[model samples]
Target: MAKLILDTFREGYGVDQIRKTMTVGELIGFLSDFDEDTPVYLGFDNRYTYGGITEGRFEMDYGEEDDE
Candidate 1:
C-alpha cells in the first residue's frame, strides 16, 4: 500500500484533502467518486507530481463554464 493525499474540490478556490494508504487503483476509484469536471491534486508527500484538470472524458474547457 502507498500513502496518498487528495486535493478534492470544494468551490471556486476551496479544496479539501484526504490522506490514506491505498493502491493506485483504489486512489483512482476514490477520485472517480467526485465530480470528474473538477480538478484534483494527488501526492504522496510534499510535492504533487500527478493529477490534472481533464479526466479524458471530453475536450478541454478553455475557461468555458458548464451549461448547468
Candidate 2:
C-alpha cells in the first residue's frame, strides 16, 4: 500500500520561529494502525510533487528547539 503525506503549512513564509511540531513517538502513534509494509510519499512543493521513501527510510529537517 502507498501513503501520501499532505503539506499542511503550504502558504507560510519565514516560519523559522514557529515551534509547532510533533515528536517521533507521536508520529509513530499516528501510524500505529497502518501496515508496516505501507509505502509513504511526501506531498512537497505542491500536491503534484512528491518525495518518496527510499529503502524504507526518509529524512526530516528540524530546528534546534525541537530537540526538547
Candidate 3:
C-alpha cells in the first residue's frame, strides 16, 4: 500500500478549520468500511505535499468580492 499523510478540516463559524491529521491507509480502511458515495473532505498543505481523506469536503469561495 502507498503511504500518505493527510490533514483534516471542517466548517466552523463560516470558515474552514484544521481538525486533525491522518494516514492514507487509515483513511482508505475507514472509507472502505463505509458505503460508497459518502461525502468526505481531504485536506492538503499550501504546497500540496500532504493530504488525507476527510469527513467533510472543502471548497473555495473566492470570487469578485474578494478580488481587488
lDDT of each: 0.52, 0.69, 0.52
> Judged by lDDT relative to the true structure, which candidate is superior, 2 or 3?
2
As a whole number from 0 to 100, the lDDT of residue 35 in candidate 2 is: 87
Q: Write the per-residue lDDT of candidate 2 for residues 1-68, one digit (tens) a residue.
A: 46747564454565565677677898899888788877777776666677766765756658588665
Model 2: lDDT of residue 23: 78
lDDT of 2: 0.69
Tens-place lDDT per residue, model 3, 3-68, is 333353344654334355456797678769655755444445543654445447556668566553
lDDT of 1 at 16: 25
Which tens-of-lDDT digit does each residue in 1-68 have in candidate 1? 33334644333442124344477798688878666556554543345454544457546445436532
Best-fitting candidate, measured by lDDT? Answer: 2
Off by over 4 Å in 3: 1-20, 41-68
In angstroms, the error of model 3 at 25 is 0.6
Per-model TM-score, in order, reads 0.29, 0.56, 0.28
Which candidate number maximizes TM-score? 2
Positional deviation of residue 44's Cα in model 1 after best superposition, in angstroms: 11
Tell me which residue pairs clash in candidate 2: none
